[model samples]
Target: MFAVHRSNGLRFLRSGTRTAAFQVRHSSTFAVWNPPKQAPREVPTPLVLCSASHWDSGTRNNIPQIFATMLAEKGHTCIEVDFGLPGDGEMCSSSQDLMDRLSEELKVNLHLSGSPFPPVIFARGFASLIAQAYISSHPAQGLFLISPPPSNTSLFPSILPTPLGEFDYELKFPVAVMACPTEMVQLRKHSRLGQDELVDLIEIDNLEGRDAFLRIEQWLDELGI
Candidate 1:
């Protein structure tokens, strides 16, 4: 359970005394966390950015925060951004516009971390599209997409339907997709991206807390991160 409160246009959610939280807002609300400043550095530390349409601005309904904290515990700096509510601008934006804005946000976060290697992107639900588009233009160190739609058309009606095969062309870095049994079936059937040489598929009932974090660390270790 998480307690939610708001102050200074930022929301706070406390799962317990140990979960460090900080929130900032732009066109979207971004919650960021890192290991304590005094903590020893993790060589080649990961910069993780998470987003999910199902999440709200606070911990009470925050999938992003859960994922963020989990990654932070693994010695990565994590940031979660909520792009308003689900379906907010899904109706009007062309694929080009979506890619442009997504790339901008990614660049900003990348600069903030200033990591020599590209950051790992973690996205769920509708936010997976944003992760996909960003990876298309800017190769990441890795990508972990949770519960992404099987098709671009299913993801957003405004964009033309495209097979996952085409998206895989842009993914030169390591990638992983985690989805529930039902969504995983459709994703595997429709998206050829999951079959790429650099891609791995993980089936999980839900990606939260310690298990998810351990899996991510294992994946990153294999990638030599």
Candidate 2:
């Protein structure tokens, strides 16, 4: 159960280093965890794409799940894309056709609903490739990559498949890469996300920990978006 509390007509929910104030309502069964103070600061919608094999099945304490729970606790909904493994047990062929189709799927399905504030995209696994394909060209408030595969690597075998080269995208927004120690090494050796301006490379011991989420919140504060 949530450790929810109310005081002086304001409902307080704890998330990371900040507390979000939800509107006090007695009759509603469900209350949105939107922060009242963030209204003026523009809290962008949390857009997440967790690459995995049926992660939302209520079985694992994965990073995406943890992040989603934190969002739920704070009265924010996580808009996520479910990209699971192929049923046939075979990766798709690396081809331009596949990239175009997935790109279209991402564009059509994901909507910018935060109104005047753009979304901060959070992508992991092969979904990171899809997000990269779009965000490299389009605009966003920020991009948070969680344990992404080496850039230009054939993660799904269709979009920019094969280890083409080091990542060389000229991103227009801030970026944060949260990786485990091993992932940190791989990413440092193969990606340019850490070296770029306004990009942060964070090493996390446990992705499901409050500390990791807190670091991200601090990064968001730095972004001021």
Candidate 3:
């Protein structure tokens, strides 16, 4: 899914004897569509829901049947893959490896494994940092960070991991962030910078142990799903 064209001052990374840079021609903005239907309407793209709390992609609790039911009701196709560690029958590896594997599996050129989707939504903060590093190497269309920990140490108390490197968040795309007030404060203070940054932070009250399915539904509705 990548192409190599000679460009000035462009150093191509070599994998084996072939050198290439990853690139995908993003189609014009389009909306998601429900399945078993004929025409594609103006709806958000299919939500590749990532798991949360170190759970595998196929874990029932990670996705919650309710969320699936709601998405089905809305007619949007939800493809939930197991992005967690191995031993669960899903592809098990580091966040970067998993991302590369996922990109190949999904037949997309974008790098998604190292973004906030897997770590914040599935593996917590430290895992998210690993994901961030991967994204830095491979770019993606959007990002979604859900209820990240205050610090990497808070999530992984035994090992203190380093923060992710700098990133450009000015790309023209929609970034949706959902977090509890407390988590939001911590993320704002540590992770997210200005209000006008890459993502539009949506702070929800009473998020402690709250079901995210309903929130996701509401989010889709607001987006005109």
TM-scores of the candidates are 0.73, 0.65, 0.50
TM-score of 1: 0.73
Instruction: Flag regions of model 1 displaced more than 4 Å.
Output: 1-25, 37-43, 54-61, 85-93, 113-116, 156-168
Q: Where does the lowest 10-residue lDDT sum fall in candidate 2? A: 23-32
What C-alpha root-mean-square deviation, in Å, does candidate 1 show against the real structure? Answer: 4.9
Across 1-225, the per-residue lDDT of candidate 3 in tens digits comes to 133332323233443322223222221011111343432442335454433334322323333223433454555554333232332355434434543443343333112222233211212233344334344444444455555444444433243222223344344444566676777887777664224475677687644234565666565566445
Tens digits of per-residue lDDT for model 1, 61-148? 3566776665565556666666543234444345555545755665665565445667778877657777777777776778888777
Writing each residue's lDDT as its tens digit, candidate 2 over 1-225 gives: 255443336455566534433332221111233333443343456544444333223334256545755664554445444443332444556534344455445554454223344567777765666677667566677888887776655343453443344345677788889888998898887677755556788998887688988987788678764
lDDT value for model 1? 0.62
Ranked by TM-score, the better of candidates 2 and 3 is 2
**Which residue pairs overlap in candidate 2's backbone?**
33-75
Instruction: Return the lDDT, model 3, position 133.
Output: 37
Candidate topping TM-score: 1
Candidate 2 lDDT score relative to the true structure: 0.57
Residue 177 of model 2, lDDT score: 91
**Cα lDDT, all candidates:** 0.62, 0.57, 0.41
Ranking of models by lDDT: 1, 2, 3
Distance from true location, Cα of 45 in model 2, Å: 3.7
